[model samples]
Target: MPYEGPRVYRRDELTYNRYLKVEELLQLQQPQSDPAHHDEMLFIIIHQAYELWFKQIIHEMESCIRAMMAHKALPAYRRLTRIIKIMQLLVNQIHILETMAPIDFLQFREKLNPASGFQSIQFREVEFLAGLGNEKLMGVFLNWPEYRDTLQRRLDGPTLRSAYYDLMRAYKYRIPEKISREPDEKEREQILDALRELYQHPNHKLPVYFLSEALIEFDEYLVLWRQHHVLVVERVIGGRKGTGGSSGVKYLESTTSKRCFPLLWEARTYLTKEPQWEAEENEVSDL
Candidate 1:
């Protein structure tokens, strides 16, 4: 039965090209510029690659949320690590776009009117899933019903921040029932007190401690990406209005101050070793 002269393969066989749909992917880069400016191809490919990575990051973030809900700190932390690595890659990828000279970008920039990177639904999903949902942004997707619906679901769903606080509550931490971007002074104090206790006595809850640190790292890199992106945009366009009719660099600059987990950053202000106290020997279940 082992007598094969020449093995035959089917057209739909699982080869690398078929599995990845490489040919179809290559065909998607149709430049909008008349006669096809050379730099337009670069611009299209870079943004497409960004969408692909955003998809992956969203996948990982959803998994991280599930892990946190299950009270599995290690699994959540692992997913967050992957997300952080992908974000680092994205930060460097922006530099590659910077290689396209300002003059080169101008050649095809007009063709991109009303088609701004600001309309990236997946990026909005990432922000919403991170607990930074803004109802005002719903207007951006008004013309795209499908994308707007998707964003509506994300807005209604639980976020990574909510899941983290729920996990802390499950572990007997005194987390508030509600935490928002702008909490009252007493609410802020309560949240910071809980975080200070964790940082000061991490031995009591090492998994929570490590996972909290990972969340902060994720927040830090997100801000770093925004900062880098603003600098690159300023270098390229220099106060020019965006293709989507926004304030361009000024709008992006404002976003750099947004934090996915503001309490984590605020917690840093309260950390100190002077009044050291030992952690209690209470066991944290389901960690």
Candidate 2:
């Protein structure tokens, strides 16, 4: 199985830092201002690096979701696990961003003008792939063509939502035999169900309890991610409005309430031993 070419493997190429050209990657930091603004350079670099990491995360998530729908389960599972762990690395970045005091950020705040983390298109794409699917948010990237193309492609792709609904329809649900290019009531419901189930990561009384539980772990990590962001902003800049015109802390708090996987969360209220309480309350008191 080994047809090794002359360059089959250069030993140094296998080293930890070999693949990365530090000169090029590290040279991307151009702060757009004077030496009087050294901290701005640090701020700019950290955020730039964060965006790079976000790009990788988005790529992996898209692949994982695609793999799952294609019935290539193992690769998808591995990719998703990697994405969740990358989130931990993402949290560590806040501590780095937090080092810039509010005063430091203010020195170049004018330079930022209308730019804000709220406008990060890659971050938004991550949200969309995680099953949030709010394509209308494409409006946010209207000013940037590169970003618009990337996000619009994700929204318009033969999405996992469509692939999943096909699975459901085959099982006797009154759903479509395939995912449609246009939105449908049934397709939307199926997407919700798939997200909820995947995100909830429940402990079903089933043969493979571990798999069921890992799903819940995935869901929890995703939410933990949102919560972690809220806290990071709170710690870094208290109550200040974002440069992007968003009400900083308040906006992020509101976002944490929106589940990336709605069904996974809602199912708990309806699936657990306590689901009966939900029904009794909904019973005739549909009031």
Candidate 3:
């Protein structure tokens, strides 16, 4: 039997450009600057790239939340690992923008007036998904009805923090029935105690321990990104007001301290190695 050579596909068949919509994507980077300053193209492309990565991060986080809620620590950990790497990439990407000299940026900066990074709906979505939802922040999107509605849903939805606590509760940890942004001293003590136990005796619950460490690392990287962003903005624009009317670097600096999982961070101060007798006593008290 004669072997038929691989059939040649028609031009209309799915080519790489068609599959990825490369043409449409390239067309989206329209510079608002008259005469189209060369650096402006770089500026627009960098942000578009960021938005693409943000979309992927949100996808991974949502899947991780579901995995956590289902008590599937391994899958959740994998997703978190991916998210941390993506965050690292994002942090490094800032350096590329830093390469554009402030003078070069100014050539087209004024054209961006009234348009700011603060208007990014997906950025807010990422924050809301991470348990950092601030209803007040929604004011930025009030005029964009579709974006506001989308963010409102995320504000009402389960967050990574809530899912993680639910997972911990399923594992019989002493998580409060209602975890609040500002927990009372009693609830705080209970949370710290549970975390202390987990950290001190990690061998007892290896999967949960691994997931907890990853969660904290995720939190740490987020802080690193914010800190790096503040530095970049300061380097680029000094103390100038943001195009979106923000205080620029000062505003970004404040966000560097925001933590998605405060309890995990606070638990660190309470972590300590206990004497052998105390360990046995604590174990017996649990029974």
What TM-score does each of the candidates earn? 0.91, 0.71, 0.92
Candidate 3 stretches greater than 4 Å from native:
1-8, 275-287
Which candidate has the highest lDDT of all?
1
Per-residue C-alpha lDDT of model 2 across residues 169-277, encoded as one tens digit per residue: 4332344456545447776676556544432322221212232234345556667767887787787678988878889889888887765434444544534354343
The sequence of per-residue lDDT tens digits that candidate 3 reaches over residues 1-287 is 89899778899799878999989988898999989998998899889999999999999999999999998887999999999999999989988888899999988898998899999888899999999998899998777889888888888888998899898888889999997766789988898899988877766676888899999998998898889888988899999999888889889988988999898988878766663433553342221
Ordered from best to worst TM-score, the candidate numbers read: 3, 1, 2
Q: What is the lDDT of residue 160 in candidate 2?
A: 41
The per-residue C-alpha lDDT of model 2 at residue 18 equals 60
lDDT of 1: 0.88
| Per-residue lDDT over 17-135 for candidate 1, one digit per residue giving the tens place of the 0 to 100 score | 88898999999999999899988988999899999999999999999999999988999999999999999999888888788899998889888897998999999999999988888
lDDT of each: 0.88, 0.62, 0.87
Report lDDT (Cα) of residue 218, candidate 3: 88
lDDT measured at residue 231 in model 1 versus the true structure, 0 to 100: 94
Q: On a 0 to 1 TM-score scale, where does candidate 2 land against the true structure? A: 0.71
Local distance difference test, candidate 2: 0.62
List runs of model 1 lying over 4 Å from the truth. Answer: 1-12, 275-287
